[model samples]
Target chain A: MTSEQDPRPRAVIVACTDGPLLVRGEIDLISASGEAIPRTRKTVALCRCGVSTIKPFCDGSHKLVGFRTDPVPPADRKRDEGIVTGEEAPPDAERSGA
Target chain B: MVVCAGSQGVDDAPVRAHCVGMNAFDWARRSGGPPEILFDARGPLSAHLLDVLQRPVPESGEMLAALLPATEIALSQSVDVLRDDDIQLALFILYGLHYGQVLPADEDWEWNPSLITARLALEREFEKRLRSCVPMPALPEVDSDAVAGALFDLTAPDPGPSLSRYAAKRATPGQLLEFLVQRSIYTLKEADPHSWAIPRLTGRAKAAMVEIQADEYGGGLPERMHSTIFAGTMRHVGLDDRYGAYVDNVPALTLTSLNMMTMFGLNRRLRGAVAGHLAAFEMTSSIPNRLYGNGFRRLGYDTNVTWYFDEHVEADAVHEQIAGRDLAGSLAEDEPQLLSDIMFGASACLTIDGWVADDMLDAWSKGLSSLRVPLAVQSFATA
Candidate 1:
């Protein structure tokens, strides 16, 4: 067991069911143009919903926008308040290979 | 000088000056451990607790036995339990028995039936007040995603006149120190209050809590521990960084805030409330912490003084996700019966914290010091 060569610390990002892509492990986060983004903590929540005031970071805006990946009961989703239209944004920005 | 309701402040100055002799701060400085609390007993319950703390164990235990009934009576008659200085201080002191360095008493007092009697009496009233006043939001479905969604919506940062916003733009150096003093009551202890819930939690919820706690404890480096980092900021700004250094200065509501967390965390049954409290706490932390950091920078304090706030801005963003989806949400999914308490806990956090902020802002707006005893230090290293 000691002799086995360990692979690289693969950064695993969990696509949270209705929220951000929770990223952890050894990961290099860069901008679209390949600029290094400074990270303060080991784990981070990258905004899946585009509505976050803090871009590239989930300021927990998915909840504000009612961003859902799985089909919730329509009645629950249609409850009277705080759900912005999810259609104009990317279907799933993290999954869209950005 | 503290001018409470525009009272004559000079008479109390000498009394406050006397408060420094062998108090919590001096003990903290010497031992780097939870200091024996030396604040004046505000009323009978606290007086009994403090006196018992000074006696040897058997004697203290006997004293407590004699006093528990009186303490229970005092708690029962309290009209405003939340603001009653005596009950609040007594509760803070009892909770202190669990978290060392706050009390220099024997460890055996931690589970003494007599002490527990007083703590329970106070907690019953305190919890009743919280549940009565802090209206719980409608419960979300008992699923990870739904519970997380509910918590997030509940704790969404308010866009109104707030303490962070006020401090960011206009607070004087003295005001900033008052702000730090108010926060020091909890920040010095930092994540320990919620840590009680760790053993009570299971499965994904437990794993998630441990992960977040790992960061809170500074990812294996003691120097980077959030509590240690906060102490560094306090020292940078020329304030005492000792735990409970400013406890005597803080108001009843301030103690109530930490006591609430301790209550939720300590009780095994309130695991759901503790999780929800942590979730709401993290969800509401980042942005205001950014504003708080900005306020320090604006006042010419450098990163040394701002690191605590700056660290929270990003750290909590990460913690919010883990706390919401993984910890609190997973807990609800696993134990659906706790779903309502989860929502109630989140709402209580927001409600109590809102009161704390309101107390500070109102005091600041009125040109009054928010502290019970205004901090004596007035000068700061300026821009």
Candidate 2:
């Protein structure tokens, strides 16, 4: 895993169960108008609930609105099996494959 | 300035004399060296502790011996230790020793066995009171997803008396300044208390804490650190931005909020409590921050004055997600035994903070000052 030539993706995003999409690593966040959203922190949580006053970046409105994500299907859960279930997996393991 | 007097050197005369005409708030502003003792003794325990702290360590033995009795007296007389000005202030000073620079004392006193004994004495009661008083939510399964969902539900917005709503819609300019003063007790040293658990935590929880803290510390830019940003807001509004500058102004309950966090963060046994505390803290921050910013803006303050609140609206939004899931949730999953404490911590945050808010709104509703001492500086009149 420490090898310089490792094939794992550097930028990963975790679809936090029933919460925001937690994005870690270097990735440009752009708006639909193609304007670059100014990223200030190293990691950012993008709003998934669609009601966040601060678009792109979450403002914790998900909780207020009772936002819910559909349960992960067993078939899809299989593909991300070890990454999600492994105790030693990195915090951003959900999308490490991409 | 009065000189240290007496052979035994246990006398508080010099400190008291020095504070004669001037209050602690003024004395703190005048003294230039390491954060001068910014508050006065609320009762015998704090009086003795402050007196001992000012004198040299070698001469502290006699004064130190008086501490336990004084603490006992203060604790016994007080109906509620949490709201006891004397006990809370003494604990704040004791904890201040660990944080450094806040208490005026010998560096050697940080590890003083006597002080630690007194601190533990106070902490045992404080924690017990907290555990008894703070309504604990029902525990969720020992899984991250369940834990996060439960936390979210636990912190869901309530239709109740809210300090943020009052600030947004109806706070007078003076009330806003009072709000800032009440918050300064903790906001000036924001995140330092929680950072204590960095070493105590491991793996996913640790990673989540660092990630959240990095942003709080301004993501490598000292100018942007949340505390510094808050200080700027204080300065922008005509208040002193120095840490502890307003300690004397706030009531005991304000100090209790920060003291509770320090208690949780500093004790490894309470690591789960600290994590839950942070989750509850961040969870409740964002929306209220938006309201807080609106409050400032409503009062004709510019972006510079409101930036601190605005920053929280975005920053805490991200932090709450990470804190609830990756930090608090993960900790509960890994250490199933801590699940109860985790819920307890979250509940404690809401209950205690709710009390603080209620106190403020109560005062405002009565057209009174929330601060124990009203701010001397007038609010910057907006055009």
What are the chain A TM-scores of the candidates, in order? Answer: 0.67, 0.63
Evaluate residue A21 in candidate 1 and report its C-alpha lDDT on the 0 to 100 scale: 85
Task: Give every prediction's interface RMSD.
Answer: 10.8, 12.2
> Which whole-number lDDT from 0 to 100 does residue B84 have in model 2?
90
Q: On residues B1-383, what C-alpha lDDT tens digit does candidate 2 reach at each position?
A: 22222111233434434432233335555665333565678888888999998887899888888888777777778899989988999999999989864655777899998899899999999999999999879889999888888987787765566778777778988888888878877887889999999999999999999999989999999888887788667666656655566778899998999899999999999999999988888888887887778889998899888989989988987888888888998999888899998899988888888888888889989988888888765455332
Per-residue lDDT, model 1, residue A5, is: 67
Question: Each candidate's DockQ score against the native complex?
Answer: 0.14, 0.15
lDDT by residue (tens digit), candidate 2, A1-98: 66388877778999987678888877878888988889988888888878787888887666555456886677766643433211111111000000
Q: Pick the candidate with the highest TM-score.
A: 2
- As a TM-score, model 1 comes out at 0.82
lDDT of each: 0.75, 0.78
DockQ of candidate 1 against the true complex: 0.14
For model 1, name the residue pairs that clash: B34-B101, B35-B101
What is the per-residue lDDT of model 1 for residues A1-98, given as tens digits with 9 covering 90 to 100? 23246564467888876667889888888999999998766788888778665668875456546667787786886662444432222111000000
What residue runs in model 2 are displaced by over 4 Å at the alpha carbon?
A1-4, A71-98, B1-36, B381-383
**Share of reference contacts kept by candidate 2:** 0.26
Query: Which lDDT tens digits does candidate 1 get at residues B109-182?
Result: 88888778778878888999998999879989888888987887777543367677677778888888888878
